[model samples]
Target: MGAFRGLAAWVVVVGVVFLVQGWLSDGALVFGDDDGLVEYESVETSELMMDAEFGHFLDRKLLQVTGSDRSNTTIRKLVVRGDRRDPTNGFKKYRDGYDVKSSHYWASVVYTGVYGFAIGVAWLLLGALITLLACFRCCCCRRKMPYAPRNRAYFWIPRILAFLLSLFAIGVIITMFIRNRQLHTQAFNIRDSIATSANDATGAVRNVTTTLTTVETLVTKYNIQGLNSGIIGSTVASLNNQSDTITNKVNTNIRTLNRLINGIEIALIVMLSITLFLVAMGMLAALMGWRTVYFLIILLGWLITALTWLLFGLFFAVNNVTTDTCQAFTEYLQAPANTTLDELLPCVDLATAASASNVVKQGVNNIVLQANNALTQIEQVSASLGRPTTLPPVCDPIGAAPDFNFTTCPNGTVLIGGVPQVVAPYVCPSNPVTTACLAQGRFVNSTQEATIKDLSIAGNDLVAIIPTVNALTNCSFVYDTFSKIVNERCPPARKALRNLWISLLLLSIALTLLTVSWIFANHRNKKPHLIHDQEYSPTGTTARVK
Candidate 1:
């Protein structure tokens, strides 16, 4: 009976020891889940989750950051509102509910331009009336008229003044020409800068998509067992669609802006050239005492002058709006949230930004985890078969969750950048005897080595893209572009517009004065001479006493 009890106790002790050993071994196999391996279903689900999260990031965060969502709003629409709210005011109260095209809006933002247009119209009407009266008198009236003596200083005075006025008009036009050229050049520079920025935005997005595609291809080409490349491909297509939408909208707006700017530049060139030619011709006609030519010049000059004033008004308004936009843009950059610029460049909310950033970090970490876990499992299998893994594990590019620092890696891990160097030494040369080579030189078999190399390469690519992704999510890239525009571009553009406006105003005034001088000079030249209370012949052939 003592021997039976002793045997039973021994059996129970052996069985318990075996079970505990099995449990420990199984626990060693379990890294985070029940199975130590990354399953296809889990990977697919992870991909889908990442796709959904990233899609939301692209829609809400990236769209706002890139300014593509508000591409339809022109500069005019951005600035000329009835209730032009101060951008410094909080966004919650002033983000919406304003009339963009109200008469009150136009008058408030561009009242100086409105007045200029009104005055230009009045000048046009007055010039037309004067031109018609002069034409009628010259062609129909045969009545005798008094003439100033040829030797009179006053007669020469008008001629001399007309000459000086012509010279002054020429100076004004030259200044206008210089300002216009500067403005044109500056505008082109700004356009190119904006184009480059748009390209950068799209390129960043493309890089993400392309890298993902490359990863998917690698997974399939290498027949990596754990990942579902199909899921990645589908996600890539969805990302492409979203990126295309943004790219198209931005391109459309850029094209429209290009057309508008080109048209305005052409008009400016034509108008300035015509005005300069007319001024010169009018001066020559007055000097030569050509009544017909002088009359023609006067008519054309009036029309040109009126048009010039109208353009002055238009550019005056443009200058005002430009100044306003600069101020608002500066304010917007300082505090992006709760401003009028939200209508033009909406910012992503904090929660969405945080969530997107988390998703990115988590996605990247999962990819690293998946690769490393697979490598570990392979190492275990090799150990079971009496072959040891020589290759080092793939390093996590990011730290653990909650604070995924790029600079920090988990224990016994190398950074993705340094993995290539660490892995280079373990790759086996061509050899038929895999076990002998692995044992002798601590080299992994060629196939396993290739998998390690591919994973390392993929990790490097992923790490390279992380900064770009972070920039897009946080809007730092877009903010940098805006900063460039405001700090470097806005001052020169605003100055050019202001200078152009002043030059236009001066030219208009100078042309108006020159027209008056020419009219006076022409009247003086055509006046008939009368002697001693006698009427001069209608034909100016002889004077007869009346």
Candidate 2:
């Protein structure tokens, strides 16, 4: 029965400790729960839960897409809506191009490591120090007994807490390493894909340029310009120059994008290495004591958790935002009224081409003049030669009132035996009139010549677009393509990275708790002999007080 007294004392001491620990951790001691979510009004719950500082962080990170570091450019500014450059500051950047150059590896691991691991550990360490002071109260007091009175409650409290903390910390560390690796893979893949996309965009530009050149060559080969001075030499020249300009701009933007992505990849690798060092620091603190580790863990935990919350927010934002942006561009491009084709394509604009069109029209009319003069000259020769000369003005353009008498064929054509024959016809011309004449001599029908000349002049409309119109029409596809990239990469990375950071933070907390428990366990037994006034006590034996 005497042996039962020590066991009974231990049971009472442990019971009191269990109750106290439960009360402290549960926040059920008539005190409010800080982390427990509640309700709010007149605002979204997300905003209420997320502080303004967190929103600021989100704003900065999002600014990377719009590149609105200071709102240098956007549609809102161009449109002059109120006094803002961009109502959302997300209206498109990079010379008003829609290109998403980002890497999750850069976004996730660096933030998690610096803010979550290093800073979080440091912050918690401070808190743990205060806890340390409480536990060390007896140590600091001036009680000069040979041995100090032991508090058994401290023993079990820290011991239990430490075991739990160490266990949790281990899981968190493993998760963080794995998460970091995943983000690295995601970043690498995205970088490669972006590189490929840039190459493709260059190809698109080249094809557009090639097509425009083809149209110019076709018109030139058929002598369309020679037929009429009003066709204007500057029109074709402008298209040729514009092609070069758009191509250079596209290539430059692509290079910039690739450079940015590559930089992120390199930075992520370096930051990951640093994260490993931080994990090692947390591990070391864990081994020391709960107070030391928690001091590092708690504060860092809050910071990391906050960042993760913001990441989760961004994960969703990327999905909807990217999709919506693509759709908006689609609508804008498809509708001529909203933004004309010329405004949309840096290559050319048809609405502004009225002057050029009129010039081409005049050139075609001049062909009619040449045709009439050639026919009148032919009839005169036929009458003089006494051939049956009744061919009315051949290929006379309808409603063309000829003001001049028969004259020379200054437009690379001349009268040969009363027939209007091309003196210098289109070289390798594919027009039926020129082709037939080349095959069967210059005695072809007037109608055929008229058709060929009209076709050559009509080629002007095709020149304005050449390779660009089709490519611009296909810009609608870019939105969907980017959406696919965002869906496959950004969202999942955001969540996984957040989880990874959170786990590491929890692990730090557990390590700190374990260390504190170790210290308390040691302190609990420090004065055991003093309590019983015994030089020695048998193993698993507690001598009862008299």
Candidate 3:
């Protein structure tokens, strides 16, 4: 008992050492700051909305409108200020009055690791001291005191209670293990969902860029009349930049989230495994009458039980923060505009989105109209030269402004899909058509005919990508991604975190009680004897009489 008291005193000293280290490392533990905390720089909203490909294309168009160099600043150039961490490397406070930079927050985040290390060292010292004391007492004190023969119930009762407590602790550990696995699985699902959505958006942007490059190549190679390859080239450049930015951002987010999830997973696994092993060994030692082993197990188990309580506190704080963040995210999804989330994912107003769509539609229509007008001039010139050709006009699939739907074209224009069929008979059969065939063929040469065919294919490609551009620019994709996270993923993840926290709490209680029961059982096993009748012989051998 004296040795056990010394061990407890040493543990208390080690705990104080750890407490002091934490306090010094984290500075003072002031709660709330009287002075307001520094705020992040505000991202200025622009009149022209920029999200994905549309934003890049609009940046070019804005340059054209202002008649200025492309160096003009745009809203997309502003860096996002969300996802900032506090000095403690924990999440930043999302609301007013909370000082995440305070030492109190840091302590809450890091106390488990600090104190767990301290308890580990304390346990090692305890084991060494206990072994040394046991050796000293065994070598010097040869006389054995007879343990009292109490009722058999006295022996069986503590053993029974310890056995029950050990069983309960094992049950709690198993439940915690299962809950931790569930939490890990839920975290992975959320990560996968985020990655999928971001990749989809990136792929859509890249597709649009690729198609535009095709269009630009055809226009430049063919030197098609009235079509400017330079504009297409610029739009492609902007899309490339947007694609790179999106890819880098997505990769960074995924890596960060993966690291965080993996760290938590490893911590939980290590803590639980050690705890279960200690509890099992403790039960085995107590049952087998291994005094030294039992003492060592008790020391280790005491450390583990205390560490479990500290872990519970850490997880409890984390769960609260997670719940708060989820609630804030849900609120942001409900009303995104003018919210803090806008700093992270700024969205354009409806009018700006509509304007962006109109610009794209009008650009497509103008390209189609120019192609048709150029074709008209070729036919009129051919007629003046007494060689009227039978070329059909190219159709504008995007019918009109404000609602670009694939409707029937006006008479004399061939639908984009039917252009090859109509123009097949009119394309020159060879590089040099006979005078009779020149009058029938639409092209003066094979190259001209090939160029026109290429133009038709490019036009079709351009028209196909307009809808994607519209969707990206309008921010519907952004809202849909957020909606999925908030509605489908957030609740389940939050619930899993809550359940994991509760399990940790329960395990902490069970391990603590189990440690107490071990101590009680050890005391019962070493109970003092009353020495009812005794006779000492000359050789110092004592005899007991009934």
Candidate 4:
């Protein structure tokens, strides 16, 4: 009982000190640990309309979450008074819907703290006064009298307090059990998502590197490299050698992405380990009566639950109060399927990968187009190159078999028996017949077509691929995706998280009630009875209650 009283006293003192410190300090917000949540950007309402990608993203977010049709600047757009609109109703964008007002957080803190602190002080003062009275009585009289027993009323108070304490502990344990499962689910989702992304990156890199090797072959085989016909052919040949450089750049960036994804995978694994450890600690704390461990568990519950509540509470508040702006951040929550961190990451990656990848996609597409054009040029050059219609000098016999002789005048004719006669034409025919050599046009075109086909595949698709990749791997994604996960899986459960602080408060109240009831019992049972089996040790006036 004395141990319990000392423990209770310490709890009251510590709680009061912290509450007083928080109240005294000019802290702008009690709940917000990171100011990034409340921060917003002031965009001209018209700018949203002009930037088609941002405009669409903004529109989809609003329509999906709130089903709001008021996207075209009718809602609370501010002007310069330096910002002339009503401050209370001014419009702002979260870019992601993951913020809360500082006012709400501080209000909750003060509301819960002030009342609890005052009640605690009252109990402390009363207990101190009672102790002083007992001490003085002992000093003045120099005699101690056995204290009396209590009535049924004193016995029942502790029984009721114990029942209430049991309930608070049960609620906390149940909440924690649910939360542990959720963390495990989230960790697995994160791991799987990272793996999926890693695979596509791998495929894209291998395909690009392997396929671009063909471009060098095309250059060499077409004689584009060796053609000494003109400067143009030499330039064309030089162009084909650069495939290696482009391949290197593509592979480098892809490998960087792969490393990042691997790091994410390892982090998720670590998070899973930490989550399991925390759950085990929670169980041990709940089961064991060690006050230190119990307090540690309480503090973990306090921070995690309080901060989560603050974040989501403010996020929801912003969504509710502001014009439809950033619902895409939470749209996944409203989706039909069970939302996972896996899915949200890809959604975020979609924007980034698409943006970065479009550059790649366009580059690859240009390669395909260029290759196709090269194939056309090869056919044209092959067709245009034909044998000239002229003969190399051919010296054949002028005399023919069986008395047939042929001769032609280069400028004169030979005559027989004084008769002028024209014989066969001059024996040497100079004009040439057509040559039959056709360049390997068909084979080169086939090779070019194959190269174009290789460059066509960019990678796996993303959800929001139509938008800019500005949000990929950014810190804002942590908040937004986290917000989405909470909104989707644990909206109902989050109330428990938010109210966990209150649960601790109620538990403290229950403990205080039990402690006060114990004190009352001690007051009445100051000298508890002792019984002996054989004989009451009454030979001396021990003054012990029977």
Better of 2 and 3 by lDDT: 3
1-546 in candidate 2: lDDT tens per residue? 888984675455445433433343234222113321111111112232322421211101111223455265433211101111121334221123222332322232123223234444554566567667766875786343344334445445655554444444444444455655675566556445444544454455445445434544544444654433223445545544554555565556556646754664465345434433443444444444445454455345434434333433343233223232333333332232223112222333343233333433344355455455555654564455454344434332222323212233344342222232341232233444464544433333455455445443443333333223433433423433343444465545444443443444444444445444544543443443444353334353555545
Top-TM-score candidate index: 1
Q: What TM-score against the true fold does each predicted structure earn?
A: 0.69, 0.42, 0.64, 0.36
lDDT of each: 0.61, 0.40, 0.59, 0.35
Each candidate's clash count: 1, 21, 0, 11
Q: Candidate 4's error at 47, in angstroms?
A: 27
Ranked candidates, highest lDDT first: 1, 3, 2, 4
Sorted by TM-score, highest first, which candidate order results? 1, 3, 2, 4
lDDT of 4 at 525: 31
Which digits, one per residue and each the tens of the lDDT, describe model 1 over residues 300-371? 888888888888888877776666666555444554444444333333333444443454466567657756
Looking at model 1, residue 41 earns an lDDT score of 19
Question: What's the C-alpha lDDT at position 31 in model 4?
Answer: 31
Model 4 regions more than 4 Å off: 1-362, 379-487, 490-493, 528-546
Over 392-414, each residue of candidate 3 has an lDDT whose tens digit, in order, gives 77778676656686566689877
**Candidate 1: RMSD over Cα atoms?**
28.0
